[model samples]
Target: MRGDGSTPPRIPGPPVRGDGVEAIVAAGGLHNYQLELHAEYGPVVRFPLPGADLAVSVADPVLLEATAAINKRPEALFEFLTPLQESGNLQTLPAEEHIPWRRVMLSVLAGRPSHEAHFARFAELTSRTADRWADRAGDEPVELQKDLSELSLRMICEYALAGGLEPEEPGRVVAAFEDVLTEYLARLYQTDAPGTEDERRARAEEALTFLRATVDRVLAAYAERDDGPPERSDLVAALVAAGESPARIRDTVLMTLLAAHHTTGVAISWTLYLLARHPDAAERAAAEVDAVLGDRAAPDYGDLKRLTYLDMVLKEAMRLYPPGPYGAREATEDLTLGEYTVPAGTTIFYPFWAVHMNPEHWPDPEVFDPERFTPEASAGRHRLAYIPFGIGPRSCEGATLAMVEAELVLAMLLKRFRFRPAADRTITPIERFVLWAAEDIPMHLTPR
Candidate 1:
């Protein structure tokens, strides 16, 4: 209620009927639905989300600040991930439990030492992918998402579980993880694919068993090591040292693998896709890469800082198409957002894509201009206006590492090849765990 004693403004939205599934479906998906809802009803809209009884979406960055401290996520929305976790669902953990866990994660994932420790392996993996792309340069267009997803998975494997597997084990791990994710995602989206539900579930279970055992093998190897744990930068080592249970450790690794790979992969792929559409940005990015690495093929850990334009390009691309388009938090107390008051227990939906497109903060929102991120342009802008990673305590802890991996890969790829969209393919954005292309982004690569 406002101090003026007049009734607060009623949050405007479409008439709430049924579970809102039909409305969401009609709008294409939740991402598009949010865009339409905000466009028609303004930044804050009360809508019936499928999983929650009452949901209010906030797209205004300034208004978003009011909900930032709410640490609890709506459990029903993330319930699908329960099967992958053993100790408990990491995504919906209570704030007390999540806080310490997040600290440990930040210590390893956010530190420069951790990134530098893993940089060489990351660079090597990117170079190998580039070599494979080089082989097929002119023959056929390359599927960026599929190949880059695998590469990101491999990089996370190296970062999470340092040096415990055999030479052939990494490939097996990648295959097993893919099997696990394929089944889970298919179930979530109800998309028909090559196999029966029972068959896919069995395969996912088998892959899950292998993955857990693999983590155990690494732990066993760590236990047997005469030298102490390699470094605090190693994720597994850090978790173990912090007295986390083995089950929690395994869940952490699985969750890390799940969160890190596809998002980073799609991020790089989308950046390249945008660059392909706008050749001028691509040229500027490429020229920056050239200046940063005159003779070297890849940027070192220190060099990522120097590739400022490439960084800006990546940030802008994410603004246009964030990897995870929306997120939700359950309000723990009555919250005042502008003139309206939201009661406790309301599901506060975060329409990240819509926030990026909000004309109030980002003028000419649809324009693919990288200069929006330059220092002068970014000055005095709302902090939450461009949240590619997400907002507040529940935000991605891997944000820093993701940037390093992306910039390095971009530098390596941009230095070696020029990416142009394939002639006939239409790249449509769809939400599968992340913002993915319905048909993978196919690009024609020519050696630079």
Candidate 2:
């Protein structure tokens, strides 16, 4: 922070407690704090938190493009995600190990298989849930976040894991994941040193071990079944067909769970919240759903595609409240960017929440306007500006699958029940592994 708007002659962070740095990071949330810092101290500043380590936020696109795309990732800071990524059977691989595993994931998540009964299962679960929700067609306050999380949990459990789901268990994994994930995000974004970094890794591994054991039992059963042609249309079958190793099966299953359940659930939850709060958007979405599915018909895959307006509605919702909020990378070597020199070990964070809401990038950043995404209007915006899934080689592997799931589930719910905000619902976003509402997104549902 200098007299002019230049990033001070040197970065102004690495402060763990005193000097007001830690307080800012702890108070404002991660990405939001980045914007607050940039607004006061200029586009780039160093934040020093003892447990998190030294880092810089670069609002400059050219510098970020050169650095983030330079083939490096934040290994230490993201180590917190390691246990979950590995044990849950998802993305624990380094760049090299990730190659084969990711390819295998692609084989299953590719669009062709999505059209089969897997997609049918998605629609089925959603429709069944809608039927239950529809029966409550009054001012009864339903927690949109809770509802979507349950609905998404069902879809992920049934489709990605074994078909028969116990209502109590997935939450064991989901709750652990969210809790640890929240702590990890706090450590990464707010701490100055890597004090408990290793300790946190140990806890993450413990949680991973629990999930891995669960996945292993499932895998053993999968192996013992030698009777007849496999009839399951879930992720296990998909992974078995993909030839995922027994050890990695848990990781992939959990990874897909994270992708399918955690992120998409938040997106759907927020979409419902936004639409419910903004009647115009909800009405527009309801209109589309009604036209496409009428009253009682469940939307087929093609029918889901025809609900283009809902897509805009979803996009705007994600733009306002991305399920996964920010992106991070580590500087492998000392790098020079516009007016600043970054240390080799510096972890670079891209405050995507800031990017999406920038006045320069998004006009009227706070308003809910689905029309902003019309094919013509969205023509030339920066491709990276709206990274709900992420970008580059590590972008969400199950993105296509998730989108189909989201569009279908949302279309079905809006068509079946209209949502309006319920008590104790607040729009304030919280960063807990993902961008989520601080409280349950409460809403009242009325049958349409």
lDDT of each: 0.89, 0.69
For model 1, residues 101-134, the per-residue Cα lDDT tens digits are 9999999999999999899999999999999999
Q: Model 2, stretches more than 4 Å misplaced?
A: 1-21, 24-26, 49-52, 60-63, 85-92, 179-210, 226-244, 333-344
Could you tell me the lDDT of residue 226 within candidate 1? 71
- Top candidate by lDDT: 1
Off by over 4 Å in 1: 1-4, 163-200
Which candidate number would show the highest TM-score if scored against the true structure?
1
**Using Cα atoms with residue i matched to residue i, what is each candidate's TM-score against the true structure?**
0.94, 0.84
lDDT by residue (tens digit), candidate 2, 57-174: 7664445665755445666656666656543323334666666766766666654554465777778878777777777668467666666777787787666654544557766767
Q: What residue pairs clash in candidate 1, if any at all?
A: none
